[model samples]
Target: MHIAEGYLPPLHAVAWTAASAPFVVHGVRVLTREVREHPESTLLLGASGAFTFVLSALKIPSVTGSCSHPTGTGLGAILFRPPVMAVLGTITLLFQALLLAHGGLTTLGANVFSMAVVGPWVGYGLYRLVRRLGLPLMVAVFAGAFAADLSTYCVTSVQLALAFPDPGSGVPGALAKFGGIFAVTQIPLAVSEGLLTVLVMRLLSQSSAGELIRLGVFARGNARQDGQQGDEQGQDRQRKRVA
Candidate 1:
């Protein structure tokens, strides 16, 4: 499912754990605030972690022997933001490492850094960027989900490449090799993941619209404001040209 037990260099593993520690701290604080202030959010946050665990555990085999799967972190990030996702995703990885024999403790840090940190942040940022650029909600979610899944594999490939570079071609070559192998499995899953997430969100929009609204999931405040400003600038430019 991942780099496997003891596959990564000890120094690299330690470094990644160190790097991810602060984000974990921040995430715990954010999650605690949500639980304390909005008690209902506890269920949602726990659901997010459970969702991540289930999706991530369903690994599809790749040609390179490493498995690929939907991270489900993108949806969580979109719902709760990336910082909160940091906590949920870390817990999910920890459970998988202990129970599933899917990944290993030695590589938990690297796994957390890739799946928990980078994937969610990239997905959340992409969703915000596209929404601000005026893409519709579903479209932005689709982009984010697809990109996040692929990006997780991208990071894992880089980590592996860094640890074991090709003798003749170095890290780049190894990176490409790893990426290509993983991409075959990952690309289709990326698309499927995007579709599934959008479908689920559509259902949630109908059933739990109020909850989502309260959570700011449907609040397009920044995107709407930015979009209006852009439109106004465009209109001004057109008027100036006509004048």
Candidate 2:
């Protein structure tokens, strides 16, 4: 969810911008390292950024100058991890701010924290956890996307509450108001995003398994297999870790 242009107070805007800068800088380093190691990731990274821009642009308007939207972070977060998604997510938000007049420049940091950093990290963590538990790939992916969208809104609600506390009720009341607004629109969108992400992942698996394999998701799955196959895959993971 975007806080919209000039919705947040200047203090809040400046604080969030400062807070998000470190993550964005670190993401740049991570992206540089990954691209150096695998030049092929350039196309994938661009596509990921494009995906985020398109999906996030399909946003639903809400009260208090905010809006709910499908954060397309989960799929990329699963594939490239949150740090990489952080960079792509920022690019997507910046594009939207400039071209679409969606989120504001001042609120860029807050938006990034919610949609990029928080959502992707939450999604990636859940995906990794579910995969480790040997769940079906589809199930893990869907849950990750669904949860990521919800988490983004949750953070957005918090940001809004922090920025505009009700005089009588304060931040908690404002949080409920914002959260209520988001819940009405965000739940179904999150589900849709999950299904969409699953479709995309399936397409990627079919058309670009090699790329996914390079990302190490497949290796992790194979490492869960029983007996000698698992042993060899585990050894391979160890080697990758060492390298």
Specify the highest-lDDT model's number: 2
Candidates in order, TM-scores: namely 0.82, 0.82
Candidate 1 regions exceeding 4 Å error are: 57-68, 220-243
Model 1: residue 41 alpha-carbon error in angstroms? 4.0
Per-model C-alpha lDDT, please? 0.79, 0.81
Q: Write the per-residue lDDT of candidate 1 for residues 54-134, one digit (tens) a residue.
A: 867565554456655668878878887889888988888888878877678889889888888888999989999998898
lDDT per residue (tens digit) for residues 1-243 in model 2: 677999999999999888888888999999999889999889988987887778666654444346556678898799878998889989988898999898989899999998889999999899989988988898899999988988999999999999889788999999999899878878877887888788777655544545566776676455333111234455465446445
Task: Give candidate 1's error at residue 174 in angstroms.
Answer: 0.9
Counted clashes in each candidate structure: 0, 0
